[model samples]
Target chain A: MFFLRRSLATSATADALAIESDSGSPAKEFKIMSGVILSRPPIITPEQTAFSKAYYHYQSELYKRMSWTFPYWFYYPKGTLAENEYTRVQPKLNEKDPDVLFNRDRNSKQDVVFPPRSVQRETEESARIYAKIVPNPRTTIADEENNIRSLERKLDRTLYLIVKRDGESLEWSFPATTIESGENLESSSTRMLAQYGGEDMNIFLVSGTPALYYKDVYESDGKYEGAKIFYLKSRIFNGLFKPQKESGIVDYAWLTKEELSSYLDKQYWRKVAGALSKQ
Target chain B: MAFFKPSFGTDLRRQSTAFFQCRSLHSSAPQFKSPVSIVHPVHHRVRYKKSILHPKYQTLLTIPKWDPRSHLFKPQAVQPSRVKTHWETTLAPDLMLANYSHNELKLRGRKHQEWDGSSPYHVNRPLRSPAGNAMATPDILPRTFRTVPFVTSIWVNTFNHRAVTEHAERNIPSTVMIQQITGVKPAPAYSGVSIMQWRLRKERNVGAVVEIKGAKKDQFLATLVEVVMPRVKDFQGIANSSGDKFGNISFGLDPEGVRLFPEIEGNPDLWSGITGLNITFVTTAQTDPEARLLLSSLGVPFYGRERFHNVPNLDGTKQTRKKGVVYYENSQE
Candidate 1:
């Protein structure tokens, strides 16, 4: 496996070495070399291939619908704040003048204090109301979560601060699962497991030009619900490459054997038929 | 006595050969059954069906009867016979030969559909949003009782005639005559609009307050009433008119008003050119919590310049504050 260092400097620092010859003679004995040959390339299983394709397809579909922004602001009409209504404004460290606050007591002289004509921070009630119109991320995150996932539990969006090679600021969002999964996202193998279900189950992953599938029968509820197989499928052109997208299938339960029996059995049920026919 | 000893020697020679033959037969039995035991489910089904259909034929055709002297055919039990056949086939020189390939090919196709829907999406169908016509509301519902101090201007660029020409031939809307004259689409016609510019403030204010010192307060108020207010209403509950494409919109303080207000322009610390405007409403119904949450979740940037409470310098320290969103989660009182 190739280790991908976040920076070129770190990559340069790492080295692998091997000693090829053990001869003791002076001229013949001396060559120390660096570099390791991988005995085998990491095998890309059919399931892994299917999973990555499905994920990319889902991402592309989401990117198309990303253009629209939500509308849900509270209405505050015109002429709410009076024209001359003002209050004691707070000043920066250097801008602070103790005389400005004390000089404007109601009993002393004027109810409203007016300092020099120089502008200070205008903490107007209208500005506050206007500022409120800004969208809060916490609420958006919550709303976005509910719109997607089927489970009641929320998917945590953890951000990783990263700087691009060009020195641009960047952040990455790691998809969330149950907290029990683990805290260190870097070590979480669940990401791979989540994409492609377990092995030892009857499954065939097809990867080429889209139509990807992740089919595995696990035990969910009492009556072999988990064994009920599911496949995540999307066309390459329609989902991954299409400029427009309509919707996504986040979570879907597998059909029971009885339910599957009603439909004319086609190609997908090869393994299913083999297992059931044995019985 | 010598003749009796000669008979014993003859019997011993014959017994030795028989014993060696029996050992050879015992060793072969286990080797034969090993292959049948490891058959995949597909192979098992094929054997099961074949055995049930033609049992009598196998019994009469192969192998000798149990009686050693008779030398007649004896029927073997299906299980034992299958076990023997499995081993024979497995150990054969041509073991890798394809026997059930035709059957396997047919099964593979069946597996594809069950795993994922192989059918293509019906592209010709009309696009329908899952949420349908439901509109979003702010997370923290704006307080009607709380007096607003400034006017909140939301710019809605419903349809751009210039952009439409590329997709399909169309003329600019009659309202965009100003956009053509100035070569600048008025703030109302800009594609992206955010209400968070007003929502992030600690104090309540009005857009009208900022307009007071501007060049034309009368014209500004007219724009607020005639153009801005209608767009806000359109967002709140836009009637299903034939022309409404439901395009992008933004909410912020009027740039004109922000520039004119001396307090905003003079304070470099408080406002970094980002302005605010308050929205005032006349409402009778109790504000719904869901509506508030919806509005709070509007296209406010959780990151970037438009996040709530991320004043360019709110704490009065000169530190450059990064922008982030405040998720308003009101208690379920």
Candidate 2:
């Protein structure tokens, strides 16, 4: 009996040592719940470029609240109502010929409207282009496109600020869009970035819900109609009021994956990230 | 035999034995009967019964010996050494001790006065004195109150008076008193105010008025610890409502009635307009002249400053700053 007990103890000790020295990757890796994939050097064709310009001009009339010396223009489908849905409208739109305006006056396009020039160079240049990001293998093509566009907006802001600081000018070409199935969105974005521009660009993958919830009623003297009561169902989720379920509010807030973790929300995003990592 | 004086210096062991023997025998006749009982004398035998001595009295009974080492005392050696050793052998030998001297001193110095060293472990206790008492001093210091200047602007509320009152009362105090008090808990400051202005479709020359009634003079002053003055949302030329209307809280002087809190006699505008109030209480004096003078001059009217409201257009078009407070309008493409 003594020998048997001794043998068991030694085996248990060996197992513990093996576990300690295994050097396998951490049982779980850090993952953001909301996945944001970024890409650049957008898959812009000549036709798409014309559409983008037309769409930009059309929306600018309403949202811009101002007219520029150089006319603001964009293309959109004839009947679309959404203000910023340029991608939806651009492909099916047309523009009045610039020839009419030019013939009426007589000035070159560059002479009529020139972008800000760099002191160091005659013309502005793009900093870099073409980035791809793969969020999770399960990420849908629609969601990936949305995330990429959002990332593009963020990058635009950042680069604008950077280039402006260096006393340089910048302009971005129309971003290209495509749906690659069952591929890594992040790695794909990176590869695209490398091919079109270069890989020195800062890349990030973020997972988050796109919605933000604020206590509008609390802030706005109860005049805010959007505030809805939410009932706590369990640790992972809350059920919003039935009346508000259709108001595009699934949770009290739309948070990035990191924020969800900080908020002690479910580790659903981590699982998604893990599945993505396998892919 | 030679006559010899007793030296009185005997072996400690022998003296204790002899002294105890005489006392045990006289204590009681029954106790002397047994050798074991006599040697070990039953506890509480009361060989010499006397009243119990207090600790101070007992301590006083023993005199400290005078030794030459008293002059050699040094404070550095008086502190105990704090070296720790690992008997479990789990910790590494080369691991440096976490030098916690600064932390210990900080904790000890910051400890509240009520913390008693008698307990083996320290427990948090409420401060015996007011939290501010630590900074109170007999010396008089300059009393200053900071006021944030606000531009005249209109506020639109889609709710009625009751909802407005409840909401304003909840959020206003923190914004109001953040400059003065610490740890402000929500209370009933909002209960006293009567909401006077309610317009659904935007009226002319009509302003929102919040009147705090029966307010103890310094009560409002107490709320301004870390005041957050709301930014005036800018709009174009004339608001849908005039400067006389919209949102501005008037105190001491009513929106309709003009009384200057006995501090001002010359300034006529004191009866109306947006005036910021900030004053420190040395001992709650009701009347301050400078505060009144400052408040009275607020609505003197910004003459010629109206031209600055126009935003220059890039297309050589005149884009005037319109009336009413503007919300965020991002022109992002």
Candidate 3:
């Protein structure tokens, strides 16, 4: 049964695990670390291109035309004052006219205009339903100020959490910590995340399995020949990162994929790029 | 009056016989049983048209399904879908992340075991019915991009007892109501069993069922979530224990709840004498929890205690939230 158990995963990390000893010596004992790629997915739909906007508008118009006709008789019964008022505003189509052929062709392109009801006549529910609503601006204060640390910025792209360690001079990396003896990747990553990033958060680890692993070797050292770091995916649904002063994290940033590339080392970016979502 | 009387009865008898081309019915008349005419199966293409086989269609050897040249082509309505757009932009990634399992193994459901072949009798014996369970549940396929849970279709049906007790045509209003809502005509359902107490017989028309797919399915879901559900008085969220062993979930709405639907609400008079609606959501998810997750993300709330399956979170724990559980939060920060 143990031999029959075949892993369903064909992940790049799984393949990387096989090639670990290919670089380092067979007897080399490597240090294991756990890292989390805490990310905030897009809040809004990506900004539409001009072509997409025009196309959607065209499609919407066509869709409206194909939709069911507004039943004037249902709402405004025949010979009622409301029905008379509704019909009076619209152009009367003559079936005998050359332009008008089918019943659908008559006023199908235009929406039925209805007479406005007096505020006094309207019920509170009807008034609430009919009230106009305006949407807030897409760009927030964080975006306006170009605040990389704030989660509010980049409303339409996947923003990742990268931290600057106290000792590291220029290296900005995903929150990671060395694995203690006998500790697994997921538990270590969760501990590292809450310690480095603040515990005041509702972030979820995507999976217990590590998404990617990075290995480095020190040829001069015999006892511990290399270091192995495994990255786990996590998502911050709600909450802000307050860097723990005791955790030795100097600074933190919430960045999109393109921005992360500039802050992360080129070699590290190559390994981590595939793990993050494009959007 | 006897025809032998040679009076007005004789004239009526002759006329009746001439028209009927059979002996007149009387107390002494031998009963006549008409022979049934049997027609053999005919060899012909149903609704066939010779013009379709013309040379004009020669260029359509590999025409796409949406192409006019294809025989099965239906013009796809280009509507700006709200749910689909939301799914692509937001829900899809979130679900993928939420559903991610650590090296997930495809779970095999109950299946019939092979014969042990220990004896001659066992060699050819029919496979034993699936070891523990009588029914075979579907395999729980590992989550992948293509296999992510989505609403395939929505089945909305309502049975009217009046159709069976009264005339079969009494179900027309329900049929029309469903058609108005779905834009697709529903097929009539029939009674499967005879019930003497209810005056129900086999083959009796019971009600109608409408299955809306693609864009219409999403529209109906959107309407239910946004408009109808909120208007239903004293409405509790869908109960936790509602799904079939498979991924499909069903819930019933009272007649009042049905009346709240915009199609019927617009003209209550037209949709009169209707019963409650039983709505089922068919999803691609392999299990109930996954299907619930998909629906909950789409703004369908669920209530009651639920045992979550493998919802591993940070802090090295598997958590479940009972009461009204919301899978998605569209909080703008």
Scored against the true structure, residue B156 in model 2 reaches a CA lDDT of 15
Under CAPRI classification, how is model 2 graded?
incorrect
lDDT to native, each model: 0.25, 0.24, 0.71
Off by over 4 Å in 2: A1-279, B1-122, B129-333
- Candidate 2 chain B: worst-modelled 10 consecutive residues by lDDT: B93-102
TM-score of each: 0.15, 0.13, 0.71
- Candidate 2 lDDT by residue in tens digits, B1-333: 223232333443454465566565565543332222224445332232233345745544454433213333212211111111110111111010110011111111112346555775556655454233442212111222211112222111111233343444333422322211221222322223433564222222122223221122123322221121111223121122222211232222121111222122222432223223322222111112112212222211111221111111222333322232111222111
lDDT of 2 at B110: 17
Order the numbered candidates by TM-score, best leading. 3, 1, 2
lDDT winner between candidates 2 and 3: 3
- Candidate 2 per-residue lDDT, tens place, A39-71, comes to 121111112257665665554432222212222
Estimate the TM-score for candidate 2.
0.13
| Segments in model 1 whose C-alpha atoms lie over 4 Å from true places | A1-279, B1-276, B280-293, B296-298, B302-333
The stretch of ten residues in a row with the least summed lDDT in candidate 2 chain A is A158-167
Per-residue accuracy of model 3 over A1-279 as CA lDDT, tens digit each: 011111222222312333346656665466556778888877776777888788767766754655556666766788888777777776666456434433235445645666766677788898887787877788999999999989999887889999888762558988878776555666677788788777888987655556677775656775566667777777788988998879988888999989988999888899888877777
Task: Evaluate model 3 with DockQ and give the value.
Answer: 0.22
Query: Across the candidates, what are chain A's individual TM-scores?
Result: 0.16, 0.15, 0.80
